[model samples]
Every structure is written in structure tokens, then in C-alpha cells.
Target: MTQPAKRTKKDKIGSGLKQQSWILLAIVLLAALIDYIWYDAHWVIAKSAALGACLSYLSQAIFAGFVFWHTGYRARRHIVRQMYRGQMVKWLLTVFGFALIFITIQPLSAPALFIGFMVMQISHSWMLWRIG
Candidate 1:
């Protein structure tokens, strides 16, 4: 009888990471919806919204980390290089960019933020599917 091939550690880790990414994506979308629909639009609620945004970004970072790690790529080194090279500057610019838009446009920020969360969730889900 022929022996079965052994699965690599990378494959195991990738599967685990994929599962985690999906769960995080679901949580992010659900949280965003709940905050939008039922939460009071007060300072405390805004704090909670910010917390959710940070969590969503953190999950995206983790998903990226897992993708790089499983593929034998230097994830943190690449992120650092990109940050120093230009991405961080652009990211900072966008922070103020969105703030300005939020202030001047007024009505667009809520939907825009929710859409951003959805985009992140979809991207994470896609990455997970790729790894799986």
C-alpha cells in the first residue's frame, strides 16, 4: 500500500489563520451594524465606534501578517519598509483627509466609515480564501 503524503506546518498554520480571519471579519461587520443602528450617537458612542474601527484595522494587520508568515515572507520588515518609504505618510494624510471631509461634508462620513469597514472585511475574507 502507498503511504499518504504528510501535511506541512505551513499548511496547518495557513488553515488556522484563515479560520481566524473569517471570524474576525464577521465580528467586524456585525459590530459596525450594531453601532450604526442602535447605539446612541453620543461622545461615549463615538469612542466605541473608534474602538471598533481600531479593532477592524488590527484584524486586517493580523490577516496580512499571517499571509506573509505562511508564505515565508518577512511581513513586519515589509510593513516597516512600506511605512517608512511612503505608505505611512499617505495613511497620515488620509487621516486628516477624512477628518476634513467629515467636517465639511458632514453627512457622508457615517456611510463612508461603514463602507470602509465592509471593504476591510471583504478583503480579509478574500485573503483567507486564498490561503485556504
Candidate 2:
């Protein structure tokens, strides 16, 4: 059996991102489970939980993707400008996502949606602290 090649700094950063992604997934699952128990196994609660998780994950992912793509081959000023613009677009996307969910999903449980989102949002800070 051969040993794996040593990883570069970029590889390490990629792995760290993967770890954070998994943590986000776990947070979503836990939120769903809590909602299931709190709402007596109602499907609506589960749906709301899923939607909330999707919103959080998608928003963060889109922003990260844009940053990674734009900063790859750019000057420092260009990167900085893109970062600011990316933030504005990311926030817009997030708000649009939430609005779409609320408008489309009838009888949604507000608590479930918020709880799911909040857990993932807070997990970002938790992951950063833990990683540090």
C-alpha cells in the first residue's frame, strides 16, 4: 500500500471547506429532527426545515463560488471590488430565496424555517472558532 501524497496549502483549505460543509449538513439534519419532534412528526415542519437549510446553504455556496472564481486570476483591486459586489448579489439572492419560499410553500411553519436557518448561520461562526 502506498501512502497518500502530502497536501498543499490549497488542498488543506479545500479540506477545511469540506469539513465546514459537512458540519452545515449535520446542523440541517439536527434542525429537521428537532422540528419533527416539536411538530409531532408533521411533514410541513420537515419541508420548512429543508427549505430553510437550502436557503442558507445555497446562499453561502453561491457567494463562495463567485469569490473563488473571480479571485483566481485577478489583481488585488479587482478581487476586492468583486468581493464587495459579490456580497451585494449574495444578499439579494438570499432575500429572493426566502421570499420565494414564503410565497410558494403554503402553511409554512415560521419557527421551523427560522430555527433551521439560524442553526446553520450560527454553525459558520462555530466552525470558524473550532477551526481556529
- Specify the highest-TM-score model's number: 2
lDDT for model 1 = 0.51
lDDT of 2 by residue, 37-84 (tens): 886766677778767866876776666665554434335577677678
Q: TM-scores for all candidates?
A: 0.29, 0.74
Candidate whose lDDT is highest: 2
**Each model's lDDT:** 0.51, 0.70
Per-residue lDDT tens digits of candidate 1, residues 1-132? 988544435555556555655655555556556656776532333333343344455544544443344222335576456445454544564466456546764334365365555555565566556656
| Candidate 2 local distance difference test against the native | 0.70
Clashes of 1: 0
Worst 10 residues of 2 by lDDT: 5-14
Clashes of each: 0, 0
